[model samples]
Target: MQTENVTKYIVNWLKDYASNAKVNGFVVGVSGGIDSAVTSSLCAETGLKVLCIEMPIHQAASHVTRAHEHITQLKERYSNVSDTRVDLTPVFEEFKTEVSLEGKQATVDMALANTRARLRMTTLYYHAGLLGLLVAGTGNKVEDFGVGFYTKYGDGGVDLSPIADLMKSEVYAVGEYLRVPHSIMEAAPSDGLFGDARSDEDQIGASYPELEWAMQMQDEGKSLEDFEGRQKEAFKIYMDYNRRNQHKMIPIPICEIPNKFR
Candidate 1:
């Protein structure tokens, strides 16, 4: 890939889109992950007002440290970049109190984890509406398209996704070119929705490189019969996720009315 050209193209695209939409700037939820760091940097390069928001709900200390470090560095490097921290822990707790925590333990835990993401999404949109900014999504190709790892109507809710086409490795490359904070660039990729330091790999059971390979194979129409041992296992994992999360990757289902009914 032409790294420099791609970088310039994305920056120009963002600027043009914002100008066409008549929005003052973009609001990105910075999670101290490679995706958000790279995204916020691209928005800053547009020379438009970019707001980096930190909405933490029972977030791990390392994640918090990295988020603050990245935001501070971004503000220092780009005059148009600004930031605000919203502590959503209390709000999350209050919400839990109002909802029933019934059902299986694992199921309840998963639901709460998704709730954290939704709360952060709401916060980002709230700021976007108030500041006349577009909600910039930080999802990458693997998560957004390959695995569908993000929460729908949560982190998946966005006005625009600047990095959705870039693979995870490509996102890291862009982050390197953008000079994202070292702490964030090196930290294990995570959703940070579970309020723990567990990496995305732990949840997905496959590293990004492995998933990328599987995605490529799937794209090439390869199937389980073609591989053995670890490759088969990895391929199966990728296929399972892709199959189950097709809803996220496809358009929402709408019932069409019959001609006679109209």
Candidate 2:
């Protein structure tokens, strides 16, 4: 679909979500990346109070700087928007102490990364609950649905996802249509966990364009027969992530007991 139509669809979608949930606004984390920037812009355009949180740990100064720049640009374009920065160093340190009792430091990197994300989610949900607003997730089709590049109950948890159906390239198209700052649009995408330690491309060993192409093929019902052995293997990895993280994409389950009938 065209950018304009997509934007309209997103705006209307948010409106419907707000009306149904009885929320006055929406909250999103702005990580100085294209996806978050695009999602924030869409939320602002929907006429809801858009709260952008810049949650950076000790290692992510660069990402936090860019987040400020993006927020400035956003404020110029939309009226009902505000931003706040919360350093997550202390929380992460505490979490590390709590988990270090296991004597397993090998997973510390991944655990810290997830802690940062979950801290941001906690803050977002806190403010969202106070304002009676929904939390907007910034993940795209390539990451969340295809590759599962989010932490469970952390960044993956949200009330709504505006860009969940759009690929990374399409997200950039929407960003361009909305005139998102060139700096943000061109900056490398990262979770800002380790301060240039690892980027999305670095972890996945592929660029967004390549990942998007693979995702499109899968979406179109293409099977392993349509790809080479290596490609099929990579596709299997992606599909496995999606399958394993299904619980993260859904609501928590509840148990029920049968009642005797008269």
Candidate 3:
């Protein structure tokens, strides 16, 4: 890919979209991950108001540090860029107190993890509404469509997704061109919703490169019978995630009323 050209294209696209929408600018949740770093940079490149928000809920120290570093660098590089931190830990705790925790341990833990993402989403939109800014999404192609790895109506809810068309590797390329902070580029990819250092690879059981390969294979219509050993295992993992999370990738289903009923 022509990294420079692609970066310009995305920046122009963002500028055009925001102009058409008549919004002041964009508000992005910076998670210190490659995607967010790249996204916020792209938004900044548009010379529009870019608000980088840090909403942490029991977040790991590394993630927080990287987020701060990136935001600081962004503000220094782009005059239109600014940042704010909203600690959501207490809010998360209060929410858990009011909800039922009677499910299986794993199930309850997963639900709470998703809750963290939803809380962050709410905070982002709150700022967006207050400032007349659009909520810019930080998701990439693999997480947004290939694996459906993000929380629905949580991080998945957004006013615009600037990098959803770029694959993970492509996103890294754009990040390199944008001069994203080195710490974020080197850190392992994570959702940071669980308040732990567990990488996205750990949760998905497949590294991005491996998943990218599997995604390509699936697109070519290859099946389990076509591979063996590790190849088969990786393919199966990709297929399982894709099938399970189809709801996130597709439009919400609606029950159509019969004309006669009306």
Candidate 4:
């Protein structure tokens, strides 16, 4: 589809969904990254009240800095835009202590990252509930739906996702078309999990283009047998992540008896 048509379609989709759900506005967690920036812009374009919240933890300096710049630009771009800064270090630390994950650095980091996402979700829901608004998810197709690169009840919990069907490359295309900040569009994508220690590519060991290609193949009903060497590896990683995180993508199982119970 054409870029303009896609943008309009997504905007209208969210608007209609929100209206039907009795939501008057949207709350988005803007990480000052391209995905969130694009999602925020689209939400604002729908004439919905867009609340862009910047929730940064101790390890996410670059993300925090970029968030401020994006928020400034968004303020200039949209009259209904509002920004909030929330530091999640204290909450993460307290949660870590309560969970007794003191000496486990990797475990603590994972927990802390999830805590940051959940904290942001909580803040968004708080404002959204008060304003009768929906929480807009910033996840892209390649990450959230394809690879499950999001927290279960954290960033993954949202009332609506404006860009969930778009891949990373498509999202960047929309970001460029929307005139999102160049720095954010060019910056390396990360989960802002471990400061400078890790990034999305570093954790996944494959770039979005490669992963998206594998996803496209899967979408086209092609089998992994068609790929060879590195392509196969990429597909394996994507499939592995999908399999491992299946629980996160679905609702909890419920016990059911048979027709007798009904």
Candidate 5:
């Protein structure tokens, strides 16, 4: 679809969903990335009150800087846009110290990262409750479904996923169409979950375009041997991630009972 059409479609969907749910507006955690930028712009486009938040838990300076720029851009572009910055480092530290690894039965790095996501989720909900807004997620198709890259009950917990159907490349297209800041459009995509500021590709082992192509091939039931050289390597990485993260993609299973028995 054309970018204009895509933008209109998502905006309409947001409006309809909110109206039916009786929610006042949208709240999104801006990571200074294209996905969140596009999502925020779409929410702002709906003429509803939009709160762009930055909850940093030992977040890098560069990421926070970009976030401020993005929030400023949004405020300039849309009257409904407002911004807030809440440092989650102290909260995360307190929680970390209080909860021992022995008690949680989890590793330090992963548990901390997941805790960061959950902390942001908590901040979002806290603000949402105060303002009567629904949490708007920024996860795109590849990250949300293809690789299951988000933390369950963390970034995964959202009232609406406006861009979840669009792939990473498709999200860039929407960002361009919305005239999102060039810095964000060109910046390396990252979850900003780590202290060293690792890009998503650094962790995922492939670029968004590469993963997108692999996902397409996976959906088509095509063999990895369909391509040669580096493309095949990408496919292998995609498959590995896909296999390991399938649990995140699938819904929780439920038992069925007969109505007659009830």
Candidate 6:
């Protein structure tokens, strides 16, 4: 696709929606990854007031560096862009420990990781509420829908999603067009949730390109056997993620028969 046009479309979309809402501006969580970097740039280009929040919850050193660098670049480029760093380590720890000590069910690793995302979500909304700005989301189509990789009610919660329609590859193309920092564009994708800093591939079981290809084929009504050999593995990973996380991708199921009477 024409990435230049895509960039313009996203920039204009942000501008239009923010104007229609008549809010203060946009609030984005800068995660120091390609998705967040690209989304931040697009929001800045809108020329509306933009707040780039670096909410680091026990993040890696490199994560801090990249987020700071990107925020610095944003400040240099846009007069409307504003930013602040909020460390959430203590908050996350307190919440987790307090729940366990109160005789509540023990929180598993996965549940705790999800809590981290929800914490970030709460922080973003807190700023947006006080500032009267919409929380601009950074999830792409692949991660948000294809594999349902995002944490539900956490990273998945947002007022608006600028890149939710674009696949992972398409997002990178738009990032290049927007002149996103080369280092960020080339960096390995991570959710920044784990203690060890695992890449997205390590967590998702397939590279983005692989997921994109498999998702494309599924959308096209093609069988996995069409791309036999090495691709079979990618397809399998895609199916596994989709099957396990399908609930996150769809709306909460309701009892239709009982509801119909209402």
Between prediction 4 and prediction 6, the one with superior TM-score is 6
Q: Count the backbone clashes (under 3 Å) in each candidate.
A: 0, 0, 0, 0, 0, 0
Give the residue spans of candidate 6 off by over 4 A: 101-107, 224-227, 256-262
lDDT of 6 by residue, 85-129 (tens): 788999998897777534334347677888889999999999999
lDDT, candidate 1, at 18: 98
Best by lDDT: 3
Clash pairs (backbone) in predicted model 5: none
- Each model's lDDT comes to 0.94, 0.82, 0.95, 0.83, 0.90, 0.88
Off by over 4 Å in 1: none
List the candidates ranked by lDDT, beginning with the highest: 3, 1, 5, 6, 4, 2
Model 5 / residue 47 / CA error / Å: 0.2
- Regarding TM-score, does 2 or 4 come out ahead? 4
Q: Residues 11-94, candidate 3, lDDT per residue (tens digit)? A: 999999999999999999999899999999999999999999999999999999999899999999999998999999999999
> What's the alpha carbon RMSD for model 4?
2.0
Residue 204 in model 5: lDDT: 85
TM-score of each: 0.99, 0.88, 0.99, 0.92, 0.94, 0.93
> What does candidate 4's lDDT look like per residue over 83-195, in tens digits?
77777778777776777667778877777677778877888898788878889998999888788899887889898788989989889988888888888998889877655
Off by over 4 Å in 2: 101-106, 220-225, 229-237, 250-262
Give the per-residue lDDT of model 1 (tens digit) for 1-262: 7778899999999999999999999999998899999999999999999999999898999999998999999889899999999999999999999999999999999999989999999999999999999999999999999999999999999999999999999998989898988888889999999889999999999999999999999999999999999999999999999999999999999999999998
Give the runs in model 3 whose Cα sits over 4 Å from its true position.
none
Give lDDT: candidate 1, residue 13. 94
- Poorest 10 consecutive residues by lDDT, candidate 5: 99-108
Clash pairs, candidate 1, are: none
How many clashes show up in model 2?
Answer: 0
Error of 6 at 242 (Å): 1.3
Q: Kindly report the root-mean-square deviation of model 2 from the true structure over all alpha carbons.
A: 2.5
